[model samples]
Structure formats: structure tokens, C-alpha cells
Target: MTSTGMTGTDTTSTGTTGEPGDRTGAHTDTDVAVVGAGPTGLLLAGDLASAGLRVTLVERRPHATGNLTRAFGVHARTLELLDARGLADELVGTGTTLTRLRLFSSLVLDLSRLRSRFPYLLVTPQYEVERLLERRARAAGVEFRRGTALRALRQDAEGVTAELAPPGDGGAVTRLRARYLVGADGVRSTVRDQLGLPFPGRSVVRSLVLADVRLADPPEDVLAANGTGDAFAFVAPFGDGWYRVMGWDRRHQVPDDVPADLDEIRGIARRALGSDFGMRDARWISRFHSDERQVPAYRVGRVLLAGDAAHVHSPAGGQGMNTGLQDAANLSWKLAAVLRGDTDDPQALLDSYHAERHPVGTAVVRGSGTIIRLAMARTPLRRAARTAVARLVTTVRPVSAAVTGMLSGIAVSYPAGRGAHRLAGRRVPDLLLAEGRLYELLRAGSFVLVAPRDTHPAAPEIAAAPGGVVRAVWANPSRRGALLVRPDGYIAWARG
Candidate 1:
């Protein structure tokens, strides 16, 4: 998902583009300038524009994009994030949902018992998520300028100035300025490069082959996958007749972009899983490496990076896209607050983003790396031991529960001090409210204070204190609780 290699690029000092506004001296472009139109940037652009901020999303490519989606599984927590934005239903409708996570032939992790409206992982393409987000962004009035490569960025105490190498050959570099900027470019991010932030990690594996094909006769386990001591192979349905085939042969450690063939994938599958489930009629094939890397810092001055630009991991648990989408949700509101001058300490609010999200990104890298390495164990004895341990954990209820929660992203929570409200910094479950679900209220893109009529007299004062930015809603008198739900559907504060 890297577009940094696009050609027709030139960055000169004093070439300007875009028709300037009616009243402007230095041509301040928009309130926020977002580089890269991936899922993270799309979500952030939509949220900021919906909040009435002038936002422009810049893409290095010339068009919207095709179906070359790399990530597949949208976990329960990511579905919850999209649900809050009123887009999850459409995405979930197009994708298949699985109640259990198949780790191997013997051990399957059940997600049916998780406490979420979306209790299962939705098997959908990364582009499907992007389409829904892009639609919302267009409706919210975000200016999308494709074919514009962000060449350079400079930031001061006021705002950020962006230099873009325009579309065609010998295209002059256009200048844009905004109150804030974000780099959502994938793995080889140009924005991250300009900022000089160190992406500190090594490549985990190279030349991992990926294929989309049809199975003549479906296997008993559609997510049929295993590591055969020397290699690994996995098969997951595309919600259509096609299935995704991913495999890595430890012996064939070749370079990426060396044209991959179908026979190579077939051989790896045969060696790893005994048979390839009669796979044929390959739709497409390619190769890529898994990297376990994280940026030292997400924010540098007025610029911040999200999505693959900030962190990348082995796509072991299908967490890459979900983690990036969640990162967008986490950063959008804080950016809106700071840009609109709603927070007393804007820098502190901005700093909170890195403080809160960096650890989550780190945890994801560690977990995914561990899973991939475990699957890459070479010896026969070690493979058997892993399978045995996996079976044992699956048999233990709490162990299985913990694994499901962590993999599905529901187990994540922030650090909130111990107040009387126990739900602070916890993900608020989608409650059945009189109007709709708790997430339905979050579509307003503001903090919602939901209180039982009998329990919290201070709801009125809390809303009043925040200058009505905190919206107050009431439940039945006997419900006996109050919850201040953040825009992201996490409980900021709650009382029972």
C-alpha cells in the first residue's frame, strides 16, 4: 500500500497551484491538510469536515483506487468505530462475519461470547472500508485533490505549509498551508520521511506470496490454515466464490517484485497443508514482506502520522487496517478540539494522542510479531508443541476469552485516574437507549452524557460546565447509571 514510488515528481521552491481564496495573503489553503487518502486519512478528513473544519485530502495517485486491498479482517472494535460513524452497517452487509477465529486446524477462538454489538470479525477488504469512509468524507464536504504528491512540509508556531508536486509531467510544486497536517501514507510514507522521524524496526519476512483464487470443493474449515514446520499456508474466503491464499516457504526467500507464479504458491500450499483444496483460476498474485516497525513519535510539531505511516506489523491477526482505522478515530477528535481552540492546553490534548495510541500500536506490533514467529517455528517438535499449547489454551475458557478479546481489539483501554466513575477510560458497550443504540448517539460526533433519570443529578451541571459541548441524554429513571461517552464510543467518565 505504498505510493511513494510514483513518478512525474518535481519539487521547486516557488511554484504555486490552486486558486487562492477571496481574502488571503500567503494563501492559507484549508483548516487541515491531510496527506494520503487511505482509510485513516479518509476517516480523519470526514470527521474534521463534519465538525465544520475546512479540510483538504491530498493523494499521491491520480484516481480513487481499485480492489488491491491488502488487509481483510475488520475486527469487532473497528466495526464499533464505523458503527459510531453510521457506516458499519453498509460494510458489514457486504462482508461475511465469523463468530470464531480459526487459529489452526485444531484451535479456533470463539468470539460469540464477546460483549459487543459486533461480536464477530467481519471479513471484508480494506478497500470496502475505504469506500464507505470516502463517501462520508465527500458528503461532509472534504476537498479531495488526487494526483497531488505532498513533496515537502514546513511548520511553525502558527500552522503547516505543504509543497505538492502536481499531477502531470514537469508539474510545478504547489504550495498549501493549513492549521494542522496528517500523514496517512502507507508503509513508505513521504510525509514521515520529510519529518525525519525514525521508523525503528526490521523487516520480519520477505517475499510472502499472496493469491486470490477459487476452490473447486471448499474445505471443511474455510479458514483452513497451518504451519507445517517448514512453511505456512492460509485460505480465507472473499465472501464470494474466491478465496485468498497466503503462504511463505522458508526456502524461497526471494526479493519482492520478482514476478510471482501460481505454481510456486501451489507447491508451498502442498508442502504446508497436504493439499491446496483444489485451488485454481487464480484472480491475482503478488508478493510483499511483513515489517514490525513503529515510528518513534506520531506527532512532530503541527504534523502527525497515522495508519501504516505510524506503525506496521506482520498481518498475522488481520490487525493492520483495524489498528489504523482506530488510530484515525482516536486522533480526529483531539485534532478537532485543538484546531477549533476548544481545549485550554491544545498541545496537551495533542500530546495525549501519542501517549494514548503509541502503546496500542506497540502492543499490536508485539502481538502480531509473536504470532508470525510462532507460526514460523522450523522444527517438527516445536510445531507440535505449539499446536499442543494452542489446544490447551483453547480448552481453557478464560484463556480463550482473553485471546479473543485481545485479537479482536476489545480489550484495549486508556489510563484514567480512579474517580468514582469506574467506567472511565473503558470502552462503553453499545447500550440499548430509548432513541437507538449508544453508538447511534455518537453519530453526532460529540461527547454524550447519558444518565439515568433517577441516578445522576449532576448530569445537568456536567453538561453546563462543558458549555453544552457535552450532550446530555436521559434513560429510564430505574436504570440507575450515568455515562459520559466520548465521540469514539469509549467511556470518558461514568457513575453507577
Candidate 2:
């Protein structure tokens, strides 16, 4: 996996199997080229490769680790997706679980009320998640072209072609062609730029400080956040010996790149929190502003965008990575189906990704924006009113559950048509039948038909469906009714 051997120079070799990433047949390889190796890209690549599609994940960086991430919360719906892939247990084992989220002094989001297998939110940094997903992608035989940047992207009705830059200067460029190209690249995406898509939004907040330091005493809560009228602060642990602290001061409206020292950050934390909790050992420190931005379209012919390339907003509920992960899950199956010609109508299958995900991405941006704006209340009266309304909403059981559901993504559903069945578009719960949990059945990477015991061999005709379309598995007839569950755990077309 050297740059010279890969995209740097026109050198190719053929290898048998279980190799890191080998060049075969010399010319540009792969059915699909993924522009980024983030969560969305890795998940989509893993699913695509596992489905026997040639996937090449192109990342600008040589290695996946070392980047400090602000993402620490994995919601219930995301946990269910991970469970389907058999990766949830490992993440759950390594992370801390918190039943509630506190955005302000008098406001708390109760997550335990959410009706799901994983009611509590898992608090672990994004690096842990990336590590696991990268492992899964590699095991799926997805080729990784690291230390190479996508310099240009162009596409036609047939396929996409990309020009890539080498790791160092004065190096020769390489050209790769694929049937489809995905821009999972970050905010400043070259793929998006080449396609001339407008990222329409403005910066929400600025001069926010981030520090992962060792605290003399960590808070008792798994996660904590508080906002005074003038400042805001939040803290979450890495489950190791370090803590991630984020805060911003409204009084100091300075440039984002202005160098921030520990003393200034600690003072802001002290204003937000009663004490800094002996904040010391400033291991990592940086500053960034939250923005609310989304592209007008997710798909343009053979090119599609996902993750931060598609949308971005404030990290109020830690929904950025989770939304991107779910987006990957939603788009992967559809893309694989179309690429493999598994579906009857490939265009419809491809269009459904945008129809379903664009609205969801829009909702996330709005929700996250609301949270950040409410937290940034400039007046004491407004802050008090926001706190009161939030607390009151949590006091009511149903409202609290709905709030948690929104934040956790458990309440996400698509349009199932005007005369659709009651269960259509609803998320199928992970039922525990006599054999095993329902998500265990989805581990094979396909849709499934769960029916009563009498229907054990009912779907024999569909059991060996091409591209793992659908299979029938019997559940407890008395408790759970027959249903058709989509690969992402949503009830596509079901009957009670």
C-alpha cells in the first residue's frame, strides 16, 4: 500500500486473495469509487463490497486514525443499524450509556423513555466508530486508495471518471473510472465542487473552543452541558483517561482562527459550569463554528453525495455522524441493487434514496439549528422561557417519548402512500422470538419477511432471491404479526 505503487505512478500487479489492496489488470479498477473514507463512505463501501460489488474507497489521508472528533453520541436507531451488522455489541461494550441529555440548566432530554432495545445514548468518540467501520470495510474486500485526493470528477450517462492527485508534490496524477462516483468527502468536497452544486447555508456560531484534556474530577453524569446567558459549555469523556470539552462565549465575538489559550477556555467553562472541574493538561485544543448547510440536490446523474457533503448543522444533539451513518445505510442497499441490476426499475430505486433521505436531512438541520439557537438565547427571559418549555415537555410522558424519538431517529418514517397499510413506513421493532432477536435475522444484508410460525417455509420461492432480495423467517404469531422489513429495519410493505 505505497503511494508510488498505487495512484502515484502507472504501476499495476495482479494478486490472488486476502491482500490489503492490489491492482489487477493494470487499468483503472472498480465498479464504484467512493471519494471519502468517513463513516458514510466506509459503511456504503462495506455494504457494496459485501454484496460482491467492486468498491474502491478513495481517501485523502493514508491512515484513518489520529483525528480528534466531536461525535460521542450514538442514538438508538443507529445502534439498531450497527446491531444488524453485528458491530453494536463491541461499540456498546466500549462506550458509556447515558439515559438523558442536558442542553441547559432546566432542560433535559430523557432518552430512556424511547421505546427501543437501546433506549440510552452511547457516548464514545467518533474515532472508535471509524476504527470499527474501517475494519468491516477492509474485511469486505473494498479497495482503499489512501493518500490520494480526488482532483477532478466528471460523469456522463454511462459512468464517472476521476482524476486523483498523489501524496507528495511533483508526483504524476492518476485517472480512475467507475460506474458511479460518491462524494462522501467532507464539507469542502471536490466532487461537489466539480459537479457545481451549491452548499447553501450560513455559519450559525463562531469562535467555539474544543479541548480534550484530563480533568482532576469528571462529572458524575455520563455527558453534561450548561449555558449561562453569556457562555455555553459541554463535556463528554473518551472512556479512556481524557475528556472532550466544547464551549463558546457570546461576549467575545472574535475571529474563529484567533489563537485561544487554555486559561480563556477554562474561564468560559467556569462561567457556564460553576467550576472548571480542575481542567488541566490541555492535550488537544482547536476552534470551530457550527453551520447549517444543505445541498439543493443529493443526486445528479451518476454522481451522488452523502454525509457532510450533503448536509451539515450544529452538533447540538450529536446527530451529524449518526445521520450520515444512517444515510449510508439507506443509500447502500439501493445503490447495490441498481448497480447489480437486482431491481426491476433501477431509476426508481436510485431516486428513492433522494426522496427519502433529503427530507430526513432537512429535518436534522432544522432540529439541530433549533437546539443551538435555543441554547444561544441572549436574554435571560428568553432562556428561562426556553428552559421552562423544555422541562414541561419532558414532564409529559408521551411528549417526552416523542422528543427522544425525534432526537434518536426512532420516529423517522417515509411516505407509504395515501392508501398504504398501517405498518407501512413504520420502523419494525427488533422483536425477540423463540429463535433470536429480529436484527439478528437482518445480518445477512437483505430485506426479510417475518411471518407467523405456520409460514416457516412460505417464502421458499423468494428464499434464494437474487442479490439477497428477501427471505422468510418465522416469528411468534401470537406476539408479532407478519411483516416485510427493509434492510434498514423499516417496514416497507407489511401486514399485521
Which one is best on lDDT? Answer: 1
Cα lDDT of candidate 1 equals 0.79
- Per-candidate Cα lDDT values, in order, are 0.79, 0.78
Clashing pairs in 2: none
lDDT of 1 by residue, 187-253 (tens): 9998899888889999998889998888887777757778765789888887978788899998899
- lDDT of residue 360 for candidate 1: 92
Residues 1-496 of candidate 2 have per-residue lDDT tens digits of 0100001111121111122122233344688899999888998899889888999999998877564776777999999999989899999887788887887767788887777889888988788888899999999999999989988877655577899987557567888888778899988888889888899999998889988888998887767788776898988876777787898999887886888888988898899887788889988788888889999878777788999999999989889999999899888877776766665545555666777788899999999888888888878788778877787776887887777888899998765654456766678778775568889878887877677665643332234232554555555456545666777887665554
Q: Estimate each model's TM-score.
A: 0.91, 0.90
